[model samples]
Target: MTPEEKYELFDRFCSNELSATEKETLTKLIRENESIAKELKLYQELNSHLDTRFTSEKEEEALENNLKAIGNSHFNRKATTKETKMIRMPAWAYAAAASVAIIFGVYFFGQSSPTYNDFANIPELSITERGNTEKNSKNAEYAFNSKDYAEAEKHLLILLSKDKNNTEYQFYYGLSLLEQDKYVATTRVFEKLYQGNSGYKYKALWFEALNQLKQKKYDQCAALLKNIPEDAEDYLRAQELLKKM
Candidate 1:
């Protein structure tokens, strides 16, 4: 589906306005398409943030009361000697004005460019099945999964030293560098991986795009994301990110 259509569906879904068939379709998409699921997750999160930031029942109530008071005061005012007239704005008009302001605030917030954190869904590192049984391997897995990138980097470096050609080590090592903002080192690792024939090729490309995204390099990120073919694991995610771009 086109981005516009997908987003429109998202809006309708969030508003609980979807018909039975549309709801079914959306449910199937979310279940079968990882990228759509992630997109919907992000969409819901953005809506929640907008609601929390812009909408307050108490504030709306106060504004409505204030508008009522102002209207009543204007109506009660004595007419001038020349019999000048005044028009009191309707209560709904005041509410509509407040709604417009909030809508504009949400519009501008939505218009802001997407960030790396918005798209980076890093997979958990697990090398225990590889039967390495090495301390550094275990430590790297633990640190990376726990989001301790510094510790992860240290262990990953040691692991890579012992197994320089291990793509799994290299991939997670690249991720560690990325989390630590070692942009130059991160891209170098990913570049090499994507250029190779390993299973990490497209995966590396995806993260490389995210690396570019972190640095706000829109053109380069878009180019990298477009290089991800349809059969790649991250193709759907790449398409979603491209739409945001």
Candidate 2:
């Protein structure tokens, strides 16, 4: 489609004005064309930002009236001074200005502080493969994977009691506590794991950093994230998050 037609379709999609057939077509295009998908994502972000920033209808109406008044005054002055025919500003000029505002707004909005959910890529809990055939292990696995952190925490506590030195259990138990906002317990569990030599050492550090992030302790979070080494699995993600901070 032509650029103008594509943008019109984007506008309609944002406004929820697309018919079912048009929606299907747009979905297919988004799947097949990376550029279309990226553009649509930006369009959605811009629309959401605009909606939040200009929530009052009265405010929007006042802004539009002011723009029209300014346009008319400028054209009327030119007509009187130069003896030239007054040319009214087209309605599309207002729309173009709004579009520019949307672009700049999205840019600045993107620069805002990041949240915990933006970086918390929670891995699935799977403890059954390591010769753990207990019922509590199975329940813990299921509950944690299902995102029932409270239930997972209960089962994990029982599992850890039976196998206290299991770093896997300790690490995931920390995650469960973090999910439940038990910050003190969460850090206690992760502190032991990261202080020891185990596969979960760096992983514990990462999650602890995320816990600090959730609590809005940026300094503590950044300190923990800095401890994650270059060879660690979450190193790149930690670096990215540090840049945002």
Candidate 3:
């Protein structure tokens, strides 16, 4: 099978939804390709992390109830004949509960999501490209790319919690933190991403340089800018920043 096809199957396998034959085929594919095998390992690790981080049934129930309330607002209540049981909660209560639930869900879920924001749609880096195989990456990317920083933060955090070793997610999580103006945390994340050899390596360096520039650390900014690869995607930006530094 092709690499992408194998990746799709691998993801299904991770989700435990692949058919027996598909699983067998994936097993065969992994046997033949070392890169696929490595990807599978990373996917497995991320799945394990998710299982650990967001395993609360109560939180899940609250979120479900909130969603149900939001969708049921238009439904008319049926009068019961037995004892005339009355549903008394106002639509506003449902709305308020759902809002609270959504906030909790976003924060807890983001803390555990598998793809963080700092790396959301970073030019050349796909979650898969950066060794992140989380199922939530796309959703997180959508939220982040659309500038819904709050929603984006939720999924990204969840993803990162699942794959802390992934520099891409860490980078994106950092960017999300930065977007929210969490400068110190953003600096730390970009520092890690900048130091790594992943696709975000140069991008992180550029961001770190930008962060330094923002803080008036001109010498540090220039130093970081100096390290951005001449052929890196952000080369021009680095040069521009350097001139200003």
Candidate 4:
């Protein structure tokens, strides 16, 4: 297809007005041309920007009208006997203005949606010693290593409740659950640790992938194992698991 034809097809695709043949033609052009790919991205962004701009404008107009009416109520009494110049707007103007003001406040002031700052201000918890005793930690670790999950779980739960942010607590809590054959709980704990930007990120992911394998969730297990960083401790094991999968 000619450049003009490709451009027209892309526009149609962006507007969702294209037929199957046109979509196929455009897709083929984009695959064969880097310029078309760039143009398609630009068009998508422009379409979104135009939508926001118009919505913001409508909001501003509504807000202005509401404020004008609130100012005119007292003035209208005197103006009623005199030559009146003020006009009344619908109460919906107030709602529109509020919506616009909020939208602008968010767009220009870098104000995020409620959830944007939700996690930001959440206080970080320090990992504390469960009983400030090395023996407890050692015993817990030993129980865990020996696959005596029941004893390990009891100790680990106590440690975790006391110092929830502790990496050791998180790891062992997950491990104990795994040993107890609590596959779903084990998966949830490990998945959280793995996906988080915490210190135990890769470790949790690696271990969770293993837990997935044990549960015979082969596809999910493979995907998670593949994401393990090469520098991570379990990278080699993950690779081995992938091959076995």
Task: Note the Cα lDDT for every prediction shown.
Answer: 0.91, 0.92, 0.72, 0.72
Q: Relative to the unseen true structure, what is the C-alpha lDDT of residue 44 in candidate 2, on a scale of 0 to 100?
A: 92
Q: What is the RMSD, in Å, between candidate 4 and the native fold over all Cα?
A: 25.6
Which candidate number maximizes TM-score?
Answer: 2
Judged by TM-score relative to the true structure, which candidate is superior, 1 or 3?
1
RMSD of each: 31.2, 28.9, 32.5, 25.6
Which pairs clash in model 1? none
TM-score, model 2 to reference = 0.60
Score every model by TM-score. 0.59, 0.60, 0.44, 0.44
TM-score of 3: 0.44
- For model 1, where is the 10-residue window of minimal lDDT? 78-87
Candidate 3, residue 226: Cα displacement in angstroms equals 1.6
lDDT tens string, model 1, 1-245?
88999999999988889999999989999999999999999998998888876778789889899999998877666445225435567899889989999999887676578789988998999997768798888888999999999999999899888889999989999999999889999999999999999999999999999999999999999999999999999999899889888
Residue 221 CA displacement from its true place in model 3, Å = 1.5
TM-score of 1: 0.59
The window of 10 residues in a row where model 3 has the poorest summed lDDT is 113-122
What is candidate 2's lDDT per residue for 96-170, written digit by digit as tens? 989999999987676577788989988999989889799999999999999999999999999989889999889
